[model samples]
Target: MKLTIFDCDGVLVNSEEIYLAAELEFLESIGAGFERKAYMQSFMGLSPGMWEAKLQTCVEAKTGAPLPRDFYAQIDRISTVRLEADLAEIPFARQGINKIAILRCVASSTPSTRLRWKLQHVGLIDLFDPHIFSGDLVANGKPAPDLFLHAATAMNALPHECVVVEDSVNGVIAGKAAGMRVIGFTAGNHCSADHGESLLRSGADIIVENYDDLAAAIERFARPH
Candidate 1:
């Protein structure tokens, strides 16, 4: 049997932009300003703890002060409001996923509570709920093989029997490191012009621009080589 692993933020929902905007706003407010591109390259797809640590490091370097104690709460407030007002699934996600027959689960950097909340909010929880895996479940996040390995093991799938669909370079690296074939997803609003190239360099087996092509990509990967 084959298993498909999906990254939640950009692959299933267009929520990456919401989180990034809130983070940038909070950072600038605290004088911990960051360039958009640099921030994306450095921190996207990281587990919450790692992301926060990196932001604190940036804040210290820029302002000689640590991030405020309420930094996460504030960002959470901002993002929660935005998410309630306007959370959208990636285009074609619902239709594509409903039609696909592969066994699948979510493996995301988002914490368990927030991950379930976001998926439920977008009406996708039923699709992958009991199978969802969060970054906090493992020792390391993206760019490390731990999370994907954990997910695969829990789902009874060998690494080689999995196909990971991810939108970030770090996620792709982790998938490949776990010995799974990966499909780089670039249909999210947050994807940059060269995002596909970045994923390729990081070892993605294929790049899919929309969920429509994702099923085909997985099928192609599943064919005997």
Candidate 2:
């Protein structure tokens, strides 16, 4: 069966900037130098562990303090508040989701619990069947094929028959590595023209800036090849 795998954060919900802003604020509150652009570019599609490792280095260089185990906990708390307040519905996302003729699911780098809460908050929990797949479920996250492959396996769909909708370079890389076609979503400011081009370089078959365009892309995919 053909399947559509969606990335959660920036695609269905407009929470990427909220999360990033929370991270930046948390780091600055703890006296770590936080550069928004640098942080986004470096950690956009990385797993929590990888993010913590990078944050540790930044903390060491800026505050000269060794990374604290509770750092992520604090960041999580801060992000939770910000997300609850700012999580936005992507325009036409629910409409596009409702129009899908194939099975669909979310595959994200965000933890499953958090992803579920966000999806529920935005009224999209029912759009997916059998729940969502998080990077935490696999040994390797985005930029590796594990997460996407896992999702495809869960749906019993072959990689080539599954199309990934993603917003980050790492996600596109993971989708391609998993032998799936990828569509880059550029609704968020984090993904620019250059970023879209990079996603194409990383193996995205198409790029779109809004759900209407995304829906059209999906329809095109449904057509006989």
Candidate 3:
């Protein structure tokens, strides 16, 4: 791979658990509930704005209750407080990143400010500061390929020359659609039991259960033909 693109929340920084817990707590506060695994499966890669716009019905269907008007605000408040205090880097992710010979960057569904906060808080900012990009950079997010394509262009690499490490199905679909090889990561606390299968179904080229194996996966799966 000539370029390595990483998703932020779960792949680069270990914040998915915090995000999921905050979301579930918000749902509880609103008297709505969801089956945790099902929620992760259906909404793992959505941004906060997209979550409200796109998954409102999904949440209602899964929880058997409609979302409150304040759902987004509450979820955002809780998640911001929690992550600002507790965001941490993924174990071995930095080690694996450092071992790679290719150029690298981050392309996440997170908004730019929040993405920077988490990465800087966890001391990962220096590794990809200037190159970090958010879904807001494009007209569409994951499952549409715009964000990944934008990342590839900004990094001066073609889609076929990039490898994406992602922890969610939408991300895998986006990477594949952008013509990059994707490695599905199940190392996050929020990963469902069937996460790997879901990502594979969405077009991941490889599945990695831990950051320790990410470098090898990139080598094996993202090679030029």
Candidate 4:
């Protein structure tokens, strides 16, 4: 059976912007000099723990005080509030999901607790299999292939038979490294000004702008070679 793995944040829940905004606000509140453009460039697709450490270092350097352990807690609180206030639906996600016949799962850099809550809030929790593989579950996260490999194994599918839908360069790299066909989703504005070329260079076989295109790409991928 063919397996399809989805990246959770930008691809499913429109949480990328929410996350960036919350991070910036939190960093600024803690007296960290946050430049949105720079921060996005560096941390857009990094695992939560990596981002947290990077943010802490930045804050420490700027404020001359080590970032509090609760800094991430504050950011999570802000993220939760913002998500509740402006929960966004990925364009055509429901319809596209209904069209797919492949076994599906989520492979995300988000922690399981936050990932489940986001999916639940967006009414998409039931659409995927119970096994949602988070980066924290693996020794190394995205760009390491561990999460995608783990998801493929859980779905009982060979890596070559899996198609990964991702919105970030790191995720595309991970999918490719895991031996899956990677499709980059550009609709969420996850990439920089180059649109999806960065993702393409990172190893995405195809880059789509919307769920319609995403569905079409999957259908094509499932076709006999």
Candidate 5:
């Protein structure tokens, strides 16, 4: 049996814009103004810890002011509120998941608590609970292969028998490094104009823009060569 690994934020839920909105607001509050397009292209797949560090450096660079250590917490609080007010699932996620015949689980960079909360909020917890894996459990996040490899091991599957469905460059890179097949997903609102091309260059084996195509992609991958 093949193991299918999913990325939560942009691939399963329509929450990328929620984080972007929260971050953009926080940056504006601190005197930084970044275009949404640039932000998504540069940082769509970073873990919160990494993003916080990057944002701290950015705030200091842009405004010539030391960023408060509490900035990350503040953004997390804001993000929670925004997500609760406006969380949505990708249009065809349920239908697609119902069609897939392989074993699947989520492996995300999101902290375990937030990951559980968000998936529960969207009613997707049942689909992946007990099998949810977080990068928080590892020393490194995506683009490093730790999280995916960990999930594969937990599921008793080998790297070559796994297929990663992701929407970000870092995730695809990590999947490739882990020796798994990678499918780039671009149906989310956060996808850039060149999202597919970027995902491919970063090492995705294929790109699927919607869940219907995702089902087909998986079936195609499962066939013997």
Candidate 6:
């Protein structure tokens, strides 16, 4: 059976905007002056470790100073409160996922602990459960093939038999690099006007705008005529 690898944040949960808002607020308060467009385009799909490193680099380059003490802790506090208040599943995601009969698991840049928490909060944890894999499990994350390849191996599926459902350019690139067919999902609020084009440029085989179309897309790849 084919396997479906789902990306957590933007693809399954509508939490990117919450994270973006909290980060933007914190950065602005710290005088980082990070632009929204620049941050989204450059950092959307990176793992937490990579994001902090890159963000700190950008902050220092802009302000000639490293991030303030407890920067991430503060952002976490803000994001947690906001997420508790606003976190929700992507529209029709649960319904769409239920329609997929093939083996499926979540492969995300989020650390395992938080990934499970978010999925549980949004009622998606039961859908993937122990099969969920995180970037923290590997040495490399999105934009590299490591996490996807690891997930494929763990699921006992070949790279070519796995289909990646992602919502970011980095993820699409990673999936293609892992020799998997990638479906770029753009229904997340974080997606900009050119988001789909960017994913295509990054090597996504198809673009799916909403969960309403996702089941059909996955079926096409999993059981081709």
Model 3 lDDT tens row, 1-225: 799999998988878899889888777666666778777766777766676776687767767777777777777888888887888888877787888778999999999988998888988899897999997898877777898899999999999889998998778888888999888999887777788998898898878998777777788755546
lDDT of 4: 0.82
Per-model TM-score, in order, reads 0.94, 0.88, 0.92, 0.88, 0.94, 0.95
Winning model by TM-score: 6
Give the per-residue lDDT digits (tens) of candidate 5, residues 29-71.
8788788866766677888777767767877888898877787
- Tell me which residue pairs clash in candidate 4: none
Q: 1-225, model 6: which lDDT tens digit per residue?
A: 389999999999989989998999889888887777778778888999999899989999989998888999999999999999999999889999998889999999999888999999999999998999999999998889999999999999999899999998888989999999999999999888888988898899899999889889988886655
Alpha carbon lDDT of each predicted model? 0.88, 0.82, 0.84, 0.82, 0.87, 0.91
Count residue pairs with overlapping backbones in model 4. 0
Supply the TM-score for candidate 5.
0.94
What would the per-residue lDDT of candidate 1 be over residues 1-225, giving only the tens digit for each residue? Answer: 389999999899989988888888888887787898778878889888888787778788999887788878988899989988889889888888886678999999998998999899888989997999999899898889899999999999999999999988889989999999999899999998888888898899888888777787888887887
Candidate 1 regions with alpha-carbon error over 4 angstroms: none
Write the number of the candidate with greater lDDT, choosing between 1 and 3.
1
Decreasing lDDT order of the candidates? 6, 1, 5, 3, 2, 4
Where is the poorest 10-residue window by lDDT in model 3? 216-225
Off by over 4 Å in 2: 29-35, 61-65, 189-193, 222-225
Question: Residue-wise lDDT of candidate 2 within 7-50, one digit each (tens)?
Answer: 99889898887887777777777787666656666677777777
lDDT of 6: 0.91
Error of 5 at 134 (Å): 1.2
Error of 5 at 53 (Å): 1.6
The residue pairs that clash in candidate 6, if any, are none
Candidate 2: lDDT of 148? 92
Native-to-model Cα distance after best TM-score fit, residue 11 in candidate 3, in Å: 0.5
RMSD to the hidden true structure, all candidates: 1.4, 2.3, 1.9, 2.3, 1.6, 1.5
- Separate clash counts for every candidate: 0, 0, 0, 0, 0, 0
For candidate 6, give the lDDT of residue 92. 88
Better candidate by TM-score, 1 or 6: 6
